[model samples]
Target chain A: MKILVCISKTPDTTAKIAFTDNNTKFDTNGVQWIINPYDEWYSLVRAIELKEADASTVIHLITVGIADAEPVIRKALALGGDEAIRVNTENSDAYYIAGQIAEIAKHGQYDLIFTGKETIDYNGSSIGGMIAEFLNIPYVALATKFELNASKAIITREIEGGEEICEVELPVVVSCQKGVAEQRIPNMRGIMAARTKPLKVTEPVAFESLTSIISFELPHAKAGVKLIPADQPEELARLLHEEAKAF
Target chain B: MPVLIFIDTAEGHVKKASLEAICYGAKIAEQLNTAAEGIVLSEVKDDLASLGKYGVTKIHHVNSVALNHLDAQVYIKVIAQIAETTRAKIIVFSNNADGKAIAPGLSVRLKAGLVSGAVTLPDTSKGFTLKKTVFSGKAFANVSVNTDKKIIALNPNAYKIETRDGVAEMIPFQAAVDDGKVKVTKVTKASGEIPLTEAEIVVSGGRGLKGPENWGMIEDLAKSLHAALACSRPVADAHWRPHNEHVGQTGIAIAPNLYIAIGISGAIQHLAGVNRSKTIVVINKDPEAPFFKAADYGIVGDAFEVVPKFTEAIKKLKGIA
Candidate 1:
């Protein structure tokens, strides 16, 4: 079985968010980049688990980013991805990125594709569905569990009130979240091996981007907290009612 | 060309978030000097005409049982056909779970530019640009959709629901339904009075609460506030709470009206999920817990003592027995 996992580079969770260039671009200065937590902790690790179960399973990692993303891709490779493909592009538009990944998936003809539920930066939660639409394959979002049964895959996804278990054939795209797999740390030997792993760089295919960021604005800072004494818990209630009107 | 809104329903009733979507679509329609129309694919038990009060001029009902459960592929196919038939220039949806599943695929099918987690109405003064939360609510971005057909998924609780005094015309729509590729095997509904995503107020706990045995205080506080229950990642990871209750960068992201955190230190990962809330109240024993910085109201005290008192205080204020 062949599986493809999509990885994205995002600022670390603790990074201070800021915009640059008249608010048209994210300020990357002093920002520490890491593999998006969902992609690494759920999607890529789940793929690695599948490979561990079936040694014949080949896991290929793909990223749609510029050369700066290679270090993050190498980290994912150390997590058990056999090879890596980079669609060398700087675009942040969701459709364009999905299109690039779709182009690669079409050529690879992988049986299964995995992506994080959403990127931590964009929080769009749109790529896996778009990729599925672009490739005309079945797609599932917010999957918490995935088990393969021969050619059919059983996936449990989070729905409105609860969870829904669904079955789909191979050649499917599943966007994974927590509960799908446990987080794995790379060993020293794995890190050493990842340095020599094949990292292929390819140009992006022609595609029309549907959206563009015009500008960015930071959220208004909170007024300093109103510290109520432990004995005055009722004051919190009074303030929530009369002042904040929270009810 | 009219503005079309997708009405999401559950258990045969329209969802609260969909009402917000309707209001948003209606306001957009007024801005464009066009009519706002809604389409529902499932068998809805609610009075479809009453929804017009939310600003929609018409509602198309498909009345199909197959759509009761979400099938994104089938939904995209049907909604695309409706958009084409209605000549809808713009489409709207609540960026909830179902919308997240459906809107992107529909955008690809229609070749329309789609923006999810929209926090504001489009600014038609220039081109079609609107504000949306990005970086997990750390910041906002004004995105422009240059496509003739545009899609916007409004973030839950971002837009207010305003009702006017008009009834929308109900149109019985006809469409062919196809079998979906994915077959649902079983469903397990969460046992909660209010689903965390749809809750207006949320009360959450963390490791500082000690263990699951001490969760009663958190529950009492949540019950007093009529809020949904949530937990920090460590609590969920330790199996003290179900994973569904976990809210953070990697878990469920929510934007409720009020969020109350007990014993949580307000890690950046946890804040990413709930920073969009309108008001935040933090209760932690540690005087220097990071959560206080993000909170509108905070109490530096032990949860065991403060939470019960807080719950009683709320109950007294609200006249709840």
Candidate 2:
């Protein structure tokens, strides 16, 4: 089985977000970058687990970004991607990135594809489903579990009220979330192997992006908290009713 | 072309988030000098005509057994046909679980530009510019969608629902349906009566509550508030609460109107999942707990004493037995 796992780079969770160039661009200064948690912890881990189960399974990692994103792709390889492919484009539009991924999938013809539910930076959650539509294949979003048997697979996807277990054949796409697999840290051996792994860079297929960011604004700073005395709990109720009006 | 909204339903009733989507679509239609219409794939038990109060002029119903569950592939086909039939210029959906699953595929099929997690109505003054939350609600970005046809998945609680007096005409639409490639095996339902995604108010607990045995106070507070229950990842990881109750970056992300967090230290991961909440109240014994930084209201007190008193106060306010 050949599986393609898509990864992306995002600012570390603790990074203080700021906009530069008169608030038109994200300020990367003094910010540390890491592989998006969803991609590294869920999607890529699940694909590696699948490959571990079957010795013949092959896992390839793909990303659409500039040279700065190569470290993130290498991290995925350390976690267990056999090879890496980077579509040399620095577009943040979800549609343009999905187009590039769909083009790569068409060339690879992999039996299964996995992508994180959404990147933490943009939080679009649109790429996997768009790719599935582009390829005309079955797509499952927020899949929490998967079990494979020959050419058929049983997948459990998170829904609003419950988890839906579905059966599907090969040549399927899944957007993975937590509970799909336990996160694995790369050991020294894996890191050494990743250093020598092949990472092929290709130019992006010509595609027009449909969306562009005009500007960014930070959320308003939180106001001074109203701290009701513990003894006056009834005052809390009054505040909730009249002030917050949350009820 | 009219504006179309996808009204998601569960247990034969229209979901509350979809009402917000209807209002959003209606406002967009009003801005564009058009009409707003809704399409439902499930068999709705609610009076479809009453939905006009939310500003929809017409509704299209296509009830089917297979439509009860969300099949993204099949929903794409059905919704694409409805959009074509109505000649929809803009399609709207609540950015919930189902909408997150369906809108992207539908966008690809319809060849429309799609924006998920849209927090406000599009600014058409200069093309279609949408404001959306990014970096897990830490910042907002205005995106310009340069497409003739557009798809928008509105954030669940971002827009308020407005009502006006009117009756919607129910229209029956027919289209060729397709059973998706995936087959259902079995479903495992979570135990909470109120789903976390749709809950307007959520009362969450943390390890500071100590153990599962001490969960009664948390449940009492949640009951009094009529809110769903949630827990930090540590509590869920330790099996003090079910995994379904977990809300964090790796758990279920919720955007409720009010989120009352009890005893949680407010890890960045936990905040990422719920920072979108309209109002946040944090209760913890330690004054230095990180949650207080993001909370609208903070109470430094012991949960054991504070929760019961708050519950009693709420019960007295509501006069509930």
Candidate 3:
């Protein structure tokens, strides 16, 4: 079975968020980047697990970004991706990025596809379903567990109040979160092998972005903390009702 | 299709988030000089006419038992049919779990531009621009939809629900139902009494609580305050609590009215998930804990002593003793 896993680069979870150019853009001065955890830990790792179980399975990783994202893609390849594809573009619009991947999937004839439920940066959980609609196939989002039996896949996804278990045939697309698989670190041998792996660069299609960033602003800072002594818990409660109005 | 709002319901009643969507759609309709209507696919037992208070002028009711359950494949097709027939220029949805699943598919099927996580109404004075939170609520972005048809999924708790004096007209909508490919077998619900997303007040703990056996005071505090229970990612990852109880960057992102942290070191990732909260209160023994910087109130005290007293105080205040 052939699988394509969509990957994205995000600021490291611990990166201090700041803006530059008068708070018009993200400040990348000392920020570190990593493969989004949802993609690396669940989507990509689960696909690799399937391949390890059946040697015939091949997992190809694809990302949409400029050359600056090559190291991020290389890390995914080093983890287990057989090869990598980078759609050459600096565009950050979710719709435009989804269009580029949809164009590729239309021609690649992939049997299955995987994507993170949402990126840690933009947190838009829209691309996987859009790709499925573009290809006119079944799409599932926020899947926690998946099992492939022959041509059918049984999946579990979280809902508002509970979880749902469903089955879809091959040629399905799924957006994965945690509980699907554990994170895997690339060993020295995998890193060495990844250096010679095929990394394809493709140009983005002619498409206009639907959204543009006007400016970026930080959240308002909180007022200085008002600490209430532990022994006077009742006074704390009174303050919450009269001042904070939390009750 | 006039400005259409998707009303989400479960157990025969409309969800609170959908009320906000209705108001949002109505506001947009007022701006566009059009009417705002609602589309209900499932069997909503609640009185549909009462939704008029939220600005919906009419309700297109599809009363089908099969439609009660959520199926994105079927929902996309049915909604598309309505969009085409009504010639709806814009559709509105509350960006909850269901909206996140269905809106994207509908956007692709209708060849529409979709903006999820919209924080405010669209700025239409200048060719349809929407300001939304990006970078995990760290920054904002202005998005302009280039398509003729557009879908906007407003983030939960980001919009206010207003009531007006009016009554909605209910009309039956005929839709073809498809037997979806996926089959649901079993559903496992989170053990917490209140879902974090829908909760107004939340009380969360972290590694500072020590162990699972020490969660009694935290649960008591949550119960006394009528707030949902949450935990830091480390607590959930360590198996001290269920995964659903986790709230952080990689976990559930919630924007409750009030968030109280007990013994939790506010990591940046954890802050990203909850910084949108209306107010934050932190209690930790470490006076230098970073959570204090972002909290409206802070208490430097041991969790073992502070939590029980806090719960008792809340119980006394609420007359629950």
Candidate 4:
């Protein structure tokens, strides 16, 4: 089986999300960049699990970014992928990025594709569905478990009220969510091998032009919490009804 | 120009998020001085005409037997074709399950400028700028669409639905609709009195409840107030609760009117999922728990003792024995 896992660069979870340039662009100042938590914790490890299940399986990693992202791509290889490819381009809005991924997927002709549910940076969960649409493949989002049986794949997704189990043919797209798997640290030997592994850097495939960012702003700070005395149930009731209006 | 809003339905009925989309499309239609029309697939239980009050000028029901279940690819094709036939310059969707899956697909096919998680109406004064959430509700961003046709996936509960007395004209749209390739042989819905997403009041428990055996207090409280029951990620991971009950950054994102958290430590991930709740009440024995920082009202007490008393108090207040 041929498996392709998609990864993106995002700010660490602890980074305070802020924008600069008069709120026109994200303020990456003092923010540490890392593989998106979703991709690292779920997609990459899950792909490694697939490789372990069958030693003959082939795994490749594709990213859409500049040469600066090469280290992260290498890190992914150290985690498990056999090779990696980077489409040298700066990250943009959902539309433009999906166009780049779809362009790559067209020629790669892989049987399975995986991406994180949404990037921690943009929080736009549009990539997997957009690529699936572009490739005309079956797509599932927020999958927790998958069981591949030759040509058929059984997948269960975390829906609003309960889990949704779906069965589909191969060449499917899945957006890995949390609880799929745990993150793994790359070992020394794998890291050394990753440095020598074939890392292909190519130009982007042209698609439609991108929509532009206008402005950004942080949410207003919330009010301080009010402590309702444990013994004053009547006061709590009155406060909830009169002041909070939360009945 | 016309507007086509895709209405998501389950068990042959409309979902709550669809109502908000109907309201949004109706208002946008009012702004454009055009009629707002809706496209509904098969198996809807609600009378299609009653939805007219939400500001639609027309209701288009495809009424296909083959379209009984949702297939993202099929819905994309159907909605895109409707836009072409109806000359819809703007298409609206509720950024819920169905919309999230299909809107991106439709955008790809039609090559329309697409924006998901739209929080407000577009700034039509200068082309079209849609406001949306970025970084998982930590910040907001505005995006501009230069394309002639725009597709917007409005976030659930982003815009309020206002109703007036006016009936929309019902028109059945004619397009070459193809059969769906995927089929849903069965729908095994969770048997619950209240669905967490649709509930106004949510009572959630974390690892504090101790075990699954002690979940009765949580259920009793939910039942007393007609609220939905929820849990934190740890509780679900521990197998004390179903994974569906888990609500956090990695779990379900919900925004109810009142969110009551019991015994939760309030990690940032968990808070990211539910900070939008209009009111939050936290009951924990630890006075310094991080959950209390975000809670609108904090009560320092044990859940076992406080919850039963709280339920009884609410029952007494409502005069329910």
True C-alpha contacts between chains kept, each model in order: 0.79, 0.75, 0.63, 0.45
- RMSD of every candidate to native, in Å, equals 1.1, 1.4, 1.7, 2.1
**CAPRI tier of model 3:** medium
The per-prediction tally of clashing pairs is 0, 0, 3, 1
Top of the candidates by DockQ = 1
Residue range A111-228, candidate 2, lDDT tens digits: 9999898888888989999999989898989888878999987899887777889999888889988788877889999999999999999999989777789999998888867888
Docking class of 4: medium
lDDT of 4 by residue, A146-238 (tens): 768797777777554556777778888888876677768999998999989999888987766546778998877769788876765455545
Give DockQ: model 1: 0.82
Write the candidate numbers in order of decreasing lDDT: 1, 2, 3, 4
**TM-score (C-alpha, index-matched) for candidate 1:** 0.98
DockQ of 4: 0.55
lDDT of 2 at B81: 90
Q: Deviation in angstroms for B182 in model 1?
A: 1.1
Best model per lDDT: 1
lDDT of 3 by residue, A1-247 (tens): 9999999999998887788787778889899999989999999999999999999998889999999999999999989979999999996677788889999888888889999999987887998988888787888888989889999989999877567788888889999987899888899998998999999999999976665566666677777789888777777778787788889
lDDT of 1 by residue, B41-154 (tens): 989889999998999889988888888878788889989889999999999999988899999999899999999999999999888999999899899999999899999999
Residue B217 Cα positional deviation in candidate 1, in Å, after optimal superposition: 1.2
Which prediction has more favorable lDDT, 3 or 4? 3
Ranking by DockQ: 1, 2, 3, 4
- Candidate 2 residue-pair clash tally: 0
Q: Indicate the docking level reached by candidate 1.
A: high
Task: Give the Å shift of residue A1 in candidate 4.
Answer: 1.7
lDDT tens readout by residue for model 2, B1-321 = 889999998768898889999999999999999999999997778999999999999998887777877778888999999988888989999988788889998888887888899999999999999999888878899988888999999988889988999989999888678977888878777755688888999999999999999999898888988899999999988899977789987687788989999999999889988988988999999999989999988789998888898889888888883
Model 1: residues >4 Å from true position, as ranges? none
